[model samples]
Target: MENQEQKKRDTNKIYFLIAVIVALLGTNMYLYFQKNKSDQRIVTVSDEKTALQTELEKLETELDQANNSTTELSTELKTKDDELKAKIAQLKTALNKGTLTAGELAKAKEDVKQLRYFVGKYTADIDDLMKKNAALTGERDSLKTTVSNVKQLADNLSKVNDSLYTKVKAGAALKTSQIQIGAFKIRNSGKETDVTRASTAQKIKVMFTVANNPIAEKGSHDIYMRVLDPAGNLIIGEGGSFTANDQDLQYTYKTAIEFNGDAKTFTLDWTNRNNFEIGTYSVILYADGYTMGRGSFSLR
Candidate 1:
């Protein structure tokens, strides 16, 4: 009986120890499963965060490009505004000068419309300014032409008046006389004599008579005579004044006569200072500052 009791106690102790070991193994398996689940969740979250950051960076780069395009467009618009203002100023000046025409204004307005169409969204004031400039140019050209014609007409009238004044200053009516001369002769105390025996240094007497006519004015008039030598050369010395027919006159080897109101006979003598040559000699006569006649003679 004692041996059997001891064997039963040993079997009970072995069963207790096996139950303890099974409990410890179940705890360890639970811990390992929980740790593996936590690690998998962490890896998934990290991948999602990386993808989101990359997407955000791409969006920011696109936004920056859009901003740059907006800035460039704004600058271009401001430059166009300045150019439009300058053109408007020029148009205003042309209008004030009265050089703008209606047709040109219409054409310029059409051009402005085309420009605005290209710009997509422009103002109306620039078109109006272009029309005004065109009108001004046309008016200025017309006025210049009118002024030029007026000046030309005035100049022509002035020239015509000067010509008329010149014609009036010249006198209208006049009278003239005819004169004649003949060969030299000698006179012996109022008796006519031939001059064939005269020496080279002897004085030659010339006689002439005037006949009154309607063309000649009846008044005391000064006469001038020019005597030429046989070689058709004038024979007067320098600084000599001779008296003929009661007229004080300067002679280039010639005679002068003072005529009364009636036809009269005149006589004068010239003292020859040189020898005669065998050629024809001539005399020209002037009366009342006009040439009257000419005559010729032969000398041996």
Candidate 2:
């Protein structure tokens, strides 16, 4: 009986040892599976992070490209705006002058249309540019109107000749005795006649014969005489007669003589208040405010 009991106890001990070994192996297997699962989760998270970083880099590149394109487009638009403004100015100048033909007007209108289209197409925030363009358009239109009015005035003046009614006849050839420095044709008529120097009281005589010129109209034309000293200074005072061809019209000078289709001699006497200088004096004759003829005489 004692031997059987001892064998039973040894069998129980062997069974217990086998069970402990199996439990330790199972624990090790479970720990290995858990560590593998943690490592796989870490690898998946790393792969997801790499994909997100690549997507962000692509987005940034696209944004940079978009900004560059915007800048280039803005620059191009500004250049186009400047070109359009210059074209508009030229067009306005041509249009208002009335000198532009039909074809040119049509072309300018088309250009203006094109400019308007371009301005309308601007997508950027260009309020200042739009305002400037509007101002330029207004200025161009104003200048066009002004030039058009000037052209009309010039055209009207081209149709009529107003200078014909103011015409006058030519005068006669002047004579030497008419410009004599002393009394009329008499030796020592007043004093010794000195062409070089004369007292302020001496009288100078002038004579001229009118010539039959077709330019001399039959109207009663006024005559003007301008006397000049040697230095070309006017000897006449400023308060001379201001009458011309017709008594109705008052000009710088006047003389009423009927032109009877013949030449006539006229004599004029100038009494001097200032001493005559030793030089040539010039006399200019005018009819109806038109210079008819000129004559000169030496005093010295």
- In model 1, the Cα lDDT at residue 117 comes to 52
In model 1, which regions exceed 4 Å deviation? 1-192, 197-201, 205-218, 237-268
lDDT by residue for model 1 (25-144), tens: 888888889888878865655454444334334433433343343222346545765565454444434333433355544454454444335333433333444456567767888889
Taking the tens digit of each residue's C-alpha lDDT, what string does model 2 give over 1-300? 999999999999999999999999999999999999989966765554454334334433433343344233358666755665565556555545624445654565566556556544543335445566678889999999999998998877754434433221213322122222232222554543434343332556656666655444565655666777789777764346654334332222234566654667666566655566777777766655445566776654
Error of 2 at 49 (Å): 52
Candidate 2 achieves a global lDDT of 0.56
Q: Pairing residues by index, what is the TM-score of model 1?
A: 0.35
Whole-model lDDT values for every prediction: 0.54, 0.56
Worst 10 residues of 2 by lDDT: 168-177
Worst 10 residues of 1 by lDDT: 169-178
